[model samples]
Target: MILQPDSKVLIQGITADIASTHGSRMKAYGTNIMAGVNPGSGGQIYHDIPSFDLVEQVVAEIGAIDTTLIFVPAYQALDAALEAIAAGIRQIVIISPGMPPLDMVHLLRKAEATETIIVGPNSPGIIIPGKLLLGTHPSEFYTPGSVGIVSRSSTLTYEIALELTKSGIGQSIGVSIGGDTIAGSSFLQWLQMLDEDENTSAIVLVGEPGGNSEEAAARYIAEAIDKPVIAYIAGRKAPAGRHWGHTGTLAMVVGRGEDVGTAQSKLAAFKSAKVPLAERPAQIPELVKKALK
Candidate 1:
């Protein structure tokens, strides 16, 4: 299930200094962060939330957990995620960054076997406007409305959301699916969810140079989604064969000389899909208005 306002959440590695910091902000946003998990830190209270040493313990304490926000160190992220899965926590958002790709491969395999939905290993998590805050997204930049935002960059997601708020275009949800090469979710997945969300009237896809995700999304939108989609592909001037901030944004070769992750290639995909493209963040509002028309 998609993250909702009432979804019961657990924070893995909550005793860590960084987790405590974000946990405070999450509470202020009214999130139902029911419990925190930190091995050996169980029974200790942090930010007024009870802490547990294991996911199973937390589950035994509090009923069923719907989602988990992982804040453990990169090295510990794999175990934290596996623990959540073993405890029947199907939906997880990994907030820790720099997790080794090999670790993600293992976690992703298990998640797939169990039908778990993971948001990020390095993601900012999901925010449902005024309803809930699951990760570290700054809440003030968002407003409740009819638009949906899905981005690969956390910071860009905030910037665009703020721009939308200032332009009177509020969002139904803003999701940062992480910047890693292997994310738990994809743009198409989030786009499909937004298309079915009654509160979402349109969509904004913020992509960067590198991966073929934008191209894949463009293809899916053309064939599946009926909603108007405004597209923005960053790193238009970025050089080829370099990682652009996100691990997933690194240019790579797949086969016989196909440049799938270039900005020009992704922009072309959007063009072919009949989706309107945004040259700059400031140009998005007008494009949204145009699409609605």
Candidate 2:
């Protein structure tokens, strides 16, 4: 399958077990939720959809071709993640949290080995307004527009869209790239798509403290791109050696005299290259408008 932006999706792991915890939000967002997988829960119903015991059964019965949101437990998350990939599922969105770093590394390697594209082991998944919504985001937060959004923070992505909406601007595509230290895709990959998209007038990137992915993206922007980019890095004051929330929010220094891992300094580099920085989240709308003008 081509995995067009509007393809059908199946959501696994959405049973009474996890539905009470996470599945409810996904259903509320208008996902097909074709079937939930919870061992003996097959034949059970959730949000009016039949539950299945395994992904193979769901795929065979429902023919959901494009995407999946893996909400299984951390211990079994890797197996579930690999299963979806092995089944030739194109876009798998992982919403489960607390995945071990080694597991994520292994999953990424497997994904590379299989040529599969995974979204998050700790992500909000992807949402293309009015077409397909396979993630945990509230539908009301987004509207259709020309700017494509890709961020490491789901709540912050919502906040940015909310700010954009208040100014009568909306998004073309909004993707939460997950805050994990090991993620399937990068902001640059998303940016390349957004840059080539005729519907996308500009791009907004949201970054956090952990890795230099944002910094590398900034350098890419400095080198190329006729499109304007507005960036904001969160968790500036995050203490060293204490990566509390997001996996990649802590900076790593290779050796002495190396400047790294601070959101403020990382974001400051953008200003040097004329990339506008939002002093605060509230300023994002204005910064985007200014960038376009």
Candidate 3:
């Protein structure tokens, strides 16, 4: 169900400068972006991709779309996603980062009812190294290989992947589960998928200090995963009595409440689970190599 070279993609806000900029990059990367939905701009062409006023029109003209990468404004994300969902688009990747959590709540309900797969409100999306591209992941630093990467932080994902790439390791697939606290998908879900994937020989989990996601994944790895895993928690806890700052973009989604999450807590969870814990990005490949031994 992951994005592939042939997956038909629809862009919801293809006309926006942000969308067009990234959309062109995605297209250049070989994504089969079938058409775009730009409301009144139907029957026109923009960036050489066919444009439509509605999701249904695109479907009728170009046929069933397998995935939709939405570039619409945060406030309008709900409507764009719901429209795509109602029209039978099963996979939705929201590129908007500041989407209201309440809107995500409403979107998730419908997604569940329709058996849809919602990737993120703040996701950098997913990729299979050199083969497929979706959302905003920078694919240049990646090369196709046997490792699988799943993370909650987009910037951290890129950094880790770059490190892996530099060490001559390649990834089978990599995904940003979501940057928000209430993500559409979860650490456990992507972990299970990676575990089942035949292409994946090992996994890299890029976690942060927020939520129980790392703890949950740690438990799953201890009990279920057949492959080796290396984890790196990306940030530190704020100073006592201080509020979360920009250094806590990953922490912003999950609160800094005591007993909830911390770098030590998540790192300890992986240690207890018997997964290799890499304290630095440069150490991941070495740890992964040792684990695979």
Off by over 4 Å in 3: 240-257
Better of 2 and 3 by lDDT: 3
Error of 1 at 229 (Å): 0.3
lDDT of each: 0.88, 0.74, 0.84
lDDT of 3 by residue, 1-293 (tens): 75679999999998998777777778898999888889899887878887899999989888999999988888999999999998999999888877887898999999999999988878888888887888788888898999999988888898888898999999998898777656888888888888899899999998876667788899999999889989998765545323222223334345545555666667788889988888789999898888778
> Number of clashing residue pairs in every model?
0, 3, 0
- Per-prediction TM-score: 0.96, 0.89, 0.93
| Model 2 regions more than 4 Å off | 1-6, 16-30, 239-244, 248-258
Ordered by TM-score, highest first, the candidates read 1, 3, 2
lDDT, residue 69, candidate 1: 93
**Structure candidate 1, residue pairs in collision:** none
**RMSD for each model, in Å, please?**
1.4, 2.6, 2.4
- Residue-level lDDT for 49 in candidate 3: 84
